[model samples]
Target: MTTVMCMKLACMTECTRQGIACMLTRTVPYATVPSFQKQDLNRTMDLGLAEDHFSRPVGSFVASDIEQLKLAIEECKKLILELPEHSERQKDTVVKLIHLRLKLQELKDPEEDEPNLRILLEHRFSKEKSKSVKQTCDKCSTIIWGLIQTWYTCTGCYYRCHSKCMNLITKPCVRSKVSHQSEYELSICPEIGLDRQDYRCAECRTPISLRGVPSEARQCDYTGQYYCSTCHWNDTAIVPARVIHNWEFEPRKVCRSSMRYLALMLSRPVLRLKEINPLLFNFVEELVEIRKLRQDILLMKPYFITCKEAMEARLLLQLQDRQHFVENDDMYSLQDLIDISSGRLSCSLTEIHTTFAKHIKLDCERCQAKGFVCELCKEGDILFPFDSHTSVCHDCSAVFHRDCYYDNSTTCPRCARMTERKQDDISDVKEA
Candidate 1:
């Protein structure tokens, strides 16, 4: 009863198969003009690159080029069906784009399985009772927005995909296959609901503002889960995870990944608050105050990041022997660092911009020498060790043995600051 009309110049072939016929012979209605018309698909008839990309791998694209590649991939996928069957290199280009996209995705996230890495969203919908209702076809990622659209979403991972896409999924889903609500409780208490400005879509890291009301957007069956509709559909996995919301910083946008990472870091007893840089500490401290101010300073889009974040993610992705970028670097939202040398977060950031390990010292050199060399460490007294011939430097107000000072050098170690001040004074006098 159905037909797949192949408009070939040689054969003018027609195949009467149910699904194949629907793909080829289906007519777009007048009402659904631009969004889902069969005729409108021809807009991608000219989707060809100047240079061949079959040989190029996605890994070859550096961090700076990955953004453009992602855009190109989206465009190329749109062109696959629209390109004429006889179009030169169209099929080949799409194949190469698919290959590159997969490779790039793997390279972008090398560590496919990370312990701390959390899933932002999942397909939380149940299977449909019948196929009578129309919905977006998953294989093509196109949906017909009607008064009512029906679809099947895996309750386990929250993947609401078309039946075709679901059947074609080769792997058993990267996300968890089951929801263990009893085991993993809501770590952070969620709001009565969420607003667009208040919550970020876990998958895309964008605000969850659907039209004006945030609740128009969907949420998981679980108590604390919330994400934009875009993240909900795009997600292929369902990792039972909790969200971290900052009630204090309600208005200023912060990535949900950042919130999750912060929660992850808080769970880490190894990292001490003292070990963090003052600036980082200030950022954490300022988080509570940011809500008071009425401005959005953060770049909210996770996929589209600033140059600094792009470079950081690029360096992280190029690692030689890591399953994935460590310490939520793959999230690319927050910069959580640990001293590789000290192997701990006990060190403090001494310099504004320097190697985290080098600039960050566990303790001052004087504190390190405590008990071993400085007997007066933490005593607020001075040490004197020379056969009862103790002396004190008036300039430094410190008691020391006469031998501690260089021969005829009146200043002690503590008085070096005064000596510099004096030298600076002399220099200023001469200059003046």
Candidate 2:
């Protein structure tokens, strides 16, 4: 158990060590611990003794054990400060420190600490563009010198600002609830007026004037809100409203907020194309093709899941990026619709379908064993739900040759056998 725990910790350390070190250097300020204590903790960890005891369930920890863990965590933090920044040893130490802290927290309040259940919507800030690219801070309305000045850009809302100004800004990240709900603003460029916005930039509140030779006020094609050049760099994006209402794929100018919000919702399978516009499938050839492929993928999902060989091979990884294809047949993402219009998604789905088909039909005997035999002909030939010529009974979901079912004119042999057995049992029960 000790060796196994050590190995698991080593694996985790290797994976997240670099990220932890980088985060520490960028964000966390240093505080030093005693030298003797740091040395003792490092020696304990190296010997795998810490893993053996601390790796047990948090509920097993007594008060003394918890206090020891707290001290060990402080020692680990001190060790991290002593080591050089971004070094492999420093990264490894950071990982251990994080694990110790988490263990302590869980031991303190196992029942109350449920981080996963909380809904905390906040900015996911990251450096934007290249260091050479010129950009402005959305918070202070000042130029962020990319070559020297430290700045952050919210990946959620594209809210660019100085690193210091990031926490000071009161504006929350703009995330549309469109994915959680089916309703969307279906109108195209629903502009009220700059007067409605008080003639100021919608994001940064910069004053706008249209009296010049060319208007400084830039109108976002997605939200119809006007913004200054800094807040809206005329970044082109496919508008969800336009795509849903008109099946338009033309990229239009959008503000940073709309750009980031649309990006957050890119792969979410919220757009029920059939419910919104069933005629779209008929009008667009690729949409029709994609829908068929998605349906086939859904059919093949059950076969792959039950087969051991298919699981080992990860046959479903073919549709890894487009997992929503396997999830539901009717739902489509904004990106999926956009790609379908561009003639890319159908070809990709065709390739993925071919791979999935190969595994379920030809490659694995275990998967093939799950196929259904035609009850009508009593033949050895196997029929699958996804097969083009096969027909499935609506009531019992039994598969058979389409011609054989048509010949019987809606009577399924399997359903008839069950009915006969049920009647025989009923008659026997009455006699008894």
Off by over 4 Å in 1: 1-82, 85-92, 106-206, 209-216, 219-432
lDDT of 2 by residue, 180-276 (tens): 4434456799997889988888877878866632338889998888988767778899898889878887899998667777777888777888887
Quality of model 2 by C-alpha lDDT: 0.70
Model 1, residue 81: C-alpha shift (Å)? 7.7
What CA RMSD would candidate 2 show? 18.2
Model 2 TM-score? 0.64
Each prediction's whole-model lDDT (CA)? 0.36, 0.70
Candidate 1 per-residue lDDT over residues 210-290, each given as its tens digit: 563552354543324466654344232122222222212222222222233233332222322233322433444332222
Q: How many residue pairs clash in each candidate?
A: 7, 0
Which residue pairs collide in model 2, if any? none
Stretches off by above 4 angstroms in model 2 are 1-121, 124-135, 140-143, 155-158, 164-170, 175-184, 204-209, 212-215, 377-380
